[model samples]
Target: MIDSHEELGAELAEKVAAAGDLEALKASGAFDELMEQIDAGRLQIDGKDGFLNLMIKAVLERGLQTELSEHLGYEKGDPAARLLPNSRNGSYPKTVASTVGDVGLAIPRDRAGTFTPQLVPRGSRRTGGLDDMIISLYAGGMTIRDIEHHLESTIGTELSRETISKITDDVLEEVMAWQSRPLDPIYPILYLDAIVVKIRDGHQVKNKAAHIAVGVDLDGVKRVLGIWIQASEGAKFWAGVCAELANRGVKDVLIACCDGLTGFPEAIQATWANTTVQTCVVHLVRASMRFVAYGDRKKVAACLRNIYTAPTIEAALTAREEFAAGEWGQKYPAALKTWENAWERFIPFLAFPPALRKVIYTTNAIESLNYQLRKIIKNRGHFPNDQAAVKLLWLAICNIEDKRARERQKTRTTDKESSGNHLVEGAATAGWIQALGVLSITYPERLEPYLS
Candidate 1:
């Protein structure tokens, strides 16, 4: 609230005296000195009255560039100076308006520059701090008008709804590139699922599917490999998605667990023949429960638990037989029949060791990923189109993937030192047994290379 030149000078001296480093002192000196000089001449100004005015001017002239460049490691100049001529340039322009007592400044541009400074520049009549305010507003699920008023009341920056939209749209291009990036060659386990988002189609809001693929590398930590959008869950769309992963060098997946989507297994097999598609037993039980009567929900749920919680597949089959004999089963015969038909896919976890079984038995891994997606999408009620939906979903996914990647790298380093030899021996032994079994099957020709 210090407004007068003398008051600003006192604050500056106090700040510089308390500063821990030369750079901080320099930054504070520049900001405070500019404010003091600007405030000194303003008529009828008290310490509190003229502070915001002088501070805004100081921010424009030196504070914006200094802070932004320091943060981004960018020198004070054109943001696009280092880019090639043919490369696409990104522009983000903001309107900054501020007043000091009676003095005011508003900066506007012709909407031409390819670089939009996240930090506002000096002498810029446009409102500064709009970028951060806009992002915060967007994250908070505020409508455009609410954001404008919030900024107006909080920082006195006059931001229009159009300007806010323009600023938020800057994230779209970044989202696109991340969605199409290449993935790893081998994912030990892949978790797949879809989140539904509301999108505007021909003036009507409708639901669209956002498919996400997350992979657990050989080190056992999870990373999001890709995100995609589809009109609906179709074999052709999923096949293309699988093909895209293959083209990105995903040669094999040890286990691909997913909800029971038609043709999903075929789509995966087409991309990597050795990949084992394990249906999510949890999802199956939930789907089955939807058909059960309310009066028998508990009993039916108990019967279903026997299928999943049994010690082994053999035990699970025995439990399944008992469940079929129960009164709940007689009432919900179709539910039990459905499980019987799909029992093979439901029981694959029984063949693997407990460590692997823990991961592949349920779709909770992908379901948790979906939970994160929902958290992000809950703020965005409706997108403009399919592309817009994909873009936002990808941005959220990339943010998650980047964080997961760092943790996974650390986990791999630790695992390598602790259990490297054990992992190799186990993998080799499993490969040998699988190879022998394939040699006795009709696909011996396909198994020859691995056997050799």
Candidate 2:
């Protein structure tokens, strides 16, 4: 006779359920038994001692049987079953993806071909949120080997590093799908940056650049446009990136805030004729401070601030000219020249009001994102290849974007017209609403088509 763990578990579950409190259950040894079942559940992949895997499998199978009963129009042993047109038919074996690992299932069937499941569902490979959970853990800096051990200890299923890699590799498809998704026709602002990580290129570990593009929608919300991996950071690759953005529906970009990236402005102009390319003010200040003596850095930074914060572009230019003629500027000639060369790009944001200018004056928004990605990259140390690096970055991107989406869902948005202006409500009111007001006033002809 075969031993009945299921019957024993059911009896235990019933007694545990009837117990008055924790001490009562502990006195009956039910708690210890449950722990034993969990420890016993360990297996190479889908271990039997794993109470969670067993429970999940049981629920899904029971759900299938219940669905089968409904489809056949009779209970398992009802007299009506004998009279039914399409009675019970045996189940065929199937496997579904799960966090505990792949769950082997025997999905009950019917004589009729009409049984479509709702729990696991027909043609569905995974249930709910398991894949996201794996990606989240990986993004939070868990290596494949670490994640494998984590799943084994927490969920009682051991998966090979190859299996974990395959799971994360799936993110590449998602990243591609997201990259090709259509963009909003007009992005008021866009910030672009890159982070370099070491990846093995066949025989040698080489630096790989992960370029990230973030767009600020009209509502002032930040959206990560895409992540691209390349051998090096150069302007040449940007042309392709800009072209891809154009193809994906970015017809116009009002302002692009970036560091002193060569050839980037030309690449952007190639796509959107009227787009204004603005150098990151914060980056320029940092570069300036590097050249200043320690004693004068604060003063140099203050002078640079006065230039960017000046109410008018002409005033900002006047302040910059004064700074170039000052003692600190004379001492750090290269720093002044740096700003002078990029002044054409730096002055655009000055034309905006303080509320609007702050949003476009720097690439800090995207830099903040890079800070998060860099943390993940630092933990990984080095990846096996470009694909591995990209896969990890994409997973991190997914987790970050998911958190943003959840936050957006919790916030309310409003589009109210007041005195011939539109306000992007929700958190947008803080500055996005004001920035929209400025864009509408500043780019009337450009904003006209999109006004609803």
Point to the candidate with the largest lDDT: 2
lDDT score, residue 357, model 1? 65
What residue pairs clash in candidate 2, if any at all? Answer: 40-49, 41-49, 41-50
In model 1, which regions exceed 4 Å deviation? 1-133, 136-146, 398-452
Per-model tally of clashing residue pairs: 15, 3
Q: Identify the candidate with maximal TM-score.
A: 2
The C-alpha local distance difference test score for the whole of candidate 2 amounts to 0.76
lDDT of 1 by residue, 1-452 (tens): 76655466444534544554577866667555645555676322333234455444444534444444444444545566455232223323444453322223222221233334444544344453445446545644465667777766765556578877777677676555555656667666788888888989897988878887777654345666677777676766878888888888787676788887778888888888887788898888877888798787887888788778788889999988988898877778888887887787788777665546677778787777678778877867788788766655654555454455445455444334322111111111123333234323533444344335
TM-scores for all candidates: the values are 0.68, 0.79
TM-score of 2: 0.79
* Tens-digit lDDT string for candidate 2 (101-151): 667788887777778888878776665657666767898888877887887
